[model samples]
Target: MMYISRRERFSAAHKLWNYEFSDEKNIEIYDKCANANFHGHNYELIVTLRGEIDKSTGYVFDLKKLSEILNQRVINKLDHKNLNLDVDFLKDLIPTAENIAFAIWNEIEAELKTANCQLHKIKLIETENNFVEYYGQMQS
Candidate 1:
C-alpha cells in the first residue's frame, strides 16, 4: 500500500460551551476558552490516505479528487468562519482542535469512500503549540 497526504489551511473562531454548566461555571472551568466573545485559530489540516496504487495511473489516488473533496467538505465550511456561530456541528460540540479534527475526518471519510479510498488520518494544528490527530482505528 502507498500513503499520500495533502495539506490545507483555514482560520476560524469558537468558544466552548457546555449547557450542563452555568455560564459562570463554564467560564471558570474552561477559562478563556469559555469566553462568549470567542477566540480564533489559524488552523492547518493534513489529510492522509492509504491504498494500493492503481497500476494504470501509477498513483494511489488522484490528487485532483482529494483537493476537490477537501475544498467542498472542509475549506468551504471552515475558512474565515466562526465555528461557534457558523458551523452546525459545533453548535452542540466543543470546537477544540481534537473535535475539529474528528469532524473533518468524518466528513471526508464519506467522500473518500466514493473514490475507493479510505480516510486514514487527520492532523489538525490549532496553533504552533497545540494540535490533534485522528486515525480511523481504535488503539488498544
Candidate 2:
C-alpha cells in the first residue's frame, strides 16, 4: 500500500475555555489559549490517503479530484471561521488541535471513500511547535 498527502492552509481563531470551569481554573488548564477574546493560527493541514495505485491511472488518487473534495468538504467550511461559534461541525467541541484534526477527518472521510481512497491520517499544524495527528478510527 502507498500513501498520498495533500497540504492546505487556512486561518482560524478559537479560545479554549470550558464554561463549567471557573475562569481561573480554565486559565490554569488552557493557559494563554483560554483568553477571553481569542487567538488565531495560520494552520497547515495535511490529509493523507492510503490505497493501492490504480493500474490504469498510475495514481493512488487523482490530485485534481482529491483537491476539489478537500476544498469543498474541509477548507471552505473551516477557513477564517471561528471554530467555537461559526462552524457547525465543530459546535460544542473545544477547538484544540486534537479536536480540530478529528473533526477535519470526519468532514472529509466519506468523500475519500467514494473516490476509492481511505483517510489514513490528519496532521494539523497549529503552530511551529504544536500539532496533532488523528487517525479516523480508534485503535485497540
Candidate 3:
C-alpha cells in the first residue's frame, strides 16, 4: 500500500485542569498548564493515509481532496478557537496533544473510509518539542 500525508496548522487555547481534582493537585500535575487563564499553541497536524494507488490517477489519494477534508473536518473546528470551550468533539476530553490526535482521528476516519482511504496516523505538534501520534488504537 502507498501512503500519503497532509499537514495543516491551527492556533488554539487550552488549560489542563481537571474539575474533579483540587486546584493544588491540578497545579502539581500540570504546572503552568493548569493556569486558569489558559495558554495558546500554534499546532501542526499531519494526517497520513494508506491505500492502493488508483491506476487511472496514479495516486493513493488526491492531495487536494485530502487537504480539503483536513480543513473542513479538523482545522475549521480548531483554528483560533478555545479547545476547552469552543470545540464540540473535544468538550469532554482534556485538551492534551495525545487526546487531540485521537479526537482528530475520530473526526475524519469515516470520511476517509468513504473515499477508499485508510487513516494511518495522526501526528499533533503542540510546540517545538511536544507532539503526539495516534494510530487509532484503543486505550486499555
Compared with the true structure, what per-residue lDDT tens digits does model 2 show for residues 21-106?
99889999999999789999999999989998888899999878888888888889889998898998899899999999988888
Better of 1 and 2 by TM-score: 2
Report the C-alpha lDDT of model 3 over 14-130, residue by residue, as the tens digit: 999888999999999999998899999999999999988887888888889989999999999999999999999998999999888999999999888835568899999999999
TM-score of 1: 0.90
What order do candidates take by lDDT, descending?
3, 2, 1
- Backbone steric clashes in candidate 2, count: 0
- Every candidate's CA RMSD: 2.0, 1.4, 1.9
Better of 1 and 2 by lDDT: 2
List model 1 lDDT by residue over 1-140, tens digit each: 67899999999988888889898899888899888788888989999998877778888788887988899888989999999779765556778887888878877787786344677889999889888889976869
- Pairs clashing within candidate 1: none
Residue 80 lDDT in candidate 3: 95
Computed on alpha carbons, the lDDT of every model, listed in order, comes to 0.84, 0.89, 0.91
Worst 10 residues of 1 by lDDT: 110-119
TM-score of each: 0.90, 0.94, 0.95
> How far is 125's C-alpha from truth in model 2 (Å)?
0.3
